[model samples]
Target: MKPTEEDNKIINNRRDFIKTTAIAAAAFMIVPRHVLGRGFVAPSDRLSIAGIGVGGKGKSDIAMFAKSGRADISFLCDVDTRRAAESVKAFPKAKYYKDWREMLDKEHKNFDAVSVSTPDHNHAVQCLGAMQLGKHVFVQKPMAHDIYEARIMTQAAEKYKVVTQMGNQGASNDGTRILKEWYEAGLIGDVHTVHAWTDRPVWPQGISWSINKANVPNELDWDLWLGTAPYKEYVNKLVPFNWRGWWDYGTGALGDMGCHLLEAPFSVLNLKYAKDVQCSVGSVYVDEFQRGYFPESCPPSSHVTLTFPKTEKTNGDIAVHWMDGGIQPVRPAELGDKEIFGDGGSGTLFTGTKGKMMCDTYGLNPRLIPLSKNENLNVTQKYKRVIDGADGHYKQWVDACIAGYGKQELSSPFEIAGPLTEALLIANLAIRGYDLKIDELGEDVYPGRSAKLLWDNDSMRITNFDEVNQFVKREYREGWKSITL
Candidate 1:
């Protein structure tokens, strides 16, 4: 068969065009998505999501996003083979990867957003990588394991101009807004102190890490699971859950619930970084005669107090007390003896000049003192409610990402979640400081005990106690780097 002369010319011209544009075409394959923002993706159209740590909470998070009907789960990554099974089944067509680094490197263009539900230690790096690719991100709380990580995440969110949200469902609830309205209206005038408590570390804490190395589970990638954390044997019970008690992995009870409970105060009072922190923690019994102090594990019980300087909403400094491991403040005299406190699981109480108010976990079941007061409470509706409250959190972020950066208000953006997380991690500095032991003579002595550690929020360090600053920005394991701007 012979081609016409005109067809032959056209084919040669097309081949030359391909040769000239190939380099640019390859580079454009990984171009920053933010450069293709609103005009590139219609706000009313669907979104694609890539999920890391797709099991347990990760599984539910992606499910919620998919349920929004506006988002498609396009990728799933998890180190544990078994944990990832359900998500892989649910999104069978979505590509699966055991290593998130591999997943992002190869398929960053396939998704419009990333949902990070990995361990606390890995959140910063994973989320930062996604943002570097210009993908909107939704990260689980506490946003990061260390103060530096949280700060970096917040700054990254803004720098990248990507829509971001922390997985604190309460932020989308009506209670926080209602509380904010009440506070702004002076119903609870000038809140001076807040007490937030949770019963957590339901997993073991205040114990020694198992020196005994166990065989790595067949379904788990132990090294990948460790991520930025230092190497350790894969203990039997640490997977699926129980990692929360270890300092290397989780942020203890405060990290688990502080964002949920303390978010109300942060929002209501417009609070940011803490001025100083101090704490006391319960001891563990290694034996009948010896007290077990495991520096690697979070204490069994702890009470941390963080002081925040005055914001526009208040006249003076605000003191927040965080109690965990089932330790709770003395019940308010106003609460009836038979009445359950904070729905019995966890609660936060705000003490103001005029009166007190409280709410259960997730900022749900908000109540004013005497309970009856809530029945007749009236304040003008101020904040717009999410279309469906907490469940709408995912949809809110998805819609905002499509709408482009700064186009919509988000309930738990990293800008807000970061400082909230810092306060908790700062409190952790005091909490972990309690475990700092030094040798005195022949006996062990504690220097960080009962110390009121001053915080230079700008520097993100403990001015009075340098030892605790070691945790402000933890050292990552070899072969890993902390995510930065």
Candidate 2:
């Protein structure tokens, strides 16, 4: 039955109700970490914070903290002084530094928390440094560039007993929570398959390292930017935004958008692990020799099929298929209605034994098939939407800190998000033309295998090659280093 107009008015009013400043302040101070997954209160009366990498996304992060009207912005660190200088206006009282390590050493015990917004490779080192000093952490997503780093950060957060949050804000959206409630209510029964895809056709889709060397920009510190990544001459094409398609710095399109697209499944299904992973690669976006162009040694696009084995505790297996570059799955013929697939970057389709559910990647909104259903058969659900206030993500973080309450709860917790990130990064690793097998429960992948070995059905481990070991970790630049567990 349709909701009555009067009923709709109340619902709409509640959704639009603005949280008063006083109430908002009280909520944080009173809330606890494990209970308040989206809010936190620091132990101190006043919280000090330092921001590393204040450009692009960092610009937005710094501004959010400024507007929180809570935290004391103590320091700003960025390799690019010009970019760092632009953000100085946001926190006029804060000091600026070029080296993150030097900032941490000089500003020791000065900050109660740190916000790490550097590229994937540097997240662990910067975050761990702050946490080692008993400081809280808010690190950007793709948690780490590789599996080992992911594990190290997760363990470190536990060891330090500090509040830690990953930057996957979509996890807290009302729609995402609704999807979880629907699944728990059995709206989708025993999900067996899922399809997630992203349409991130950003510039520099994929370029292998074949390019005519070009002059490096004087304004940019290419060496500092490359950090621990392999040494290479400057090619303006891969700098700025196109690095996502490269192997050395970014994790291609999947890693770029996977955390957003994969959040729903990873949260709802407890998709704690996967096995029997196989990846199919598409043609390179451009010829390999086109150096310094868009894709500096990455595939333009590819599709990976990750099949999970049924454990003794479960009766059925689950398969997840990932698509990119305008690729999509053919709608299952059994469903009666056509589903709404958002025109945005990424989306998820959950298929269960009885019905299906659909959601856009960012958890913006969701729809259920068979729009009409019997109440007796369907379960009841309630949703409370977070009001529009933390328009800036860092505002959410800083506000929690000032309240002197449990502040580790993240918009995205690293514990839940770490595996989801690893799954996507592993998928990207598979596309590098390797047959990879991972032990989900063991939290490790087979170390020995050939590059082109085909997927094995029974063991999931490739019989001939050592794919997992190749990504164990990476070598760091002399000064720029990742934190080890």
- Best candidate, TM-score-wise? 1
Each model's lDDT = 0.90, 0.69
lDDT of 1 by residue, 204-245 (tens): 888778764578889998899999999988776888788998
Worst 10 residues of 1 by lDDT: 36-45
Off by over 4 Å in 2: 1-44, 210-212, 285-296, 309-315, 332-339, 370-396, 399-408, 434-464, 478-482
RMSD of 2: 14.9
Q: Taking the tens digit of each residue's C-alpha lDDT, what string does model 2 give over 1-485?
A: 99999999998777666546668888867766678565454455456888988887777776666566566778988887666767887778888887787888988767888888888766777888887887878877788887667777877877887767677767767667677778878776878888988776575655545554678766567776777787877665665677767677777778777787888777667775566566665554234674222323456556777776564322487788888876777664544555456444568888888788878877666767554442345446664444442253465566555543354345665677777776776676577633234588878453322233333423323444555446646677676656765
User: Which clashing pairs does model 1 show?
Assistant: none
Residue 230 deviation, candidate 1, in Å?
A: 0.5
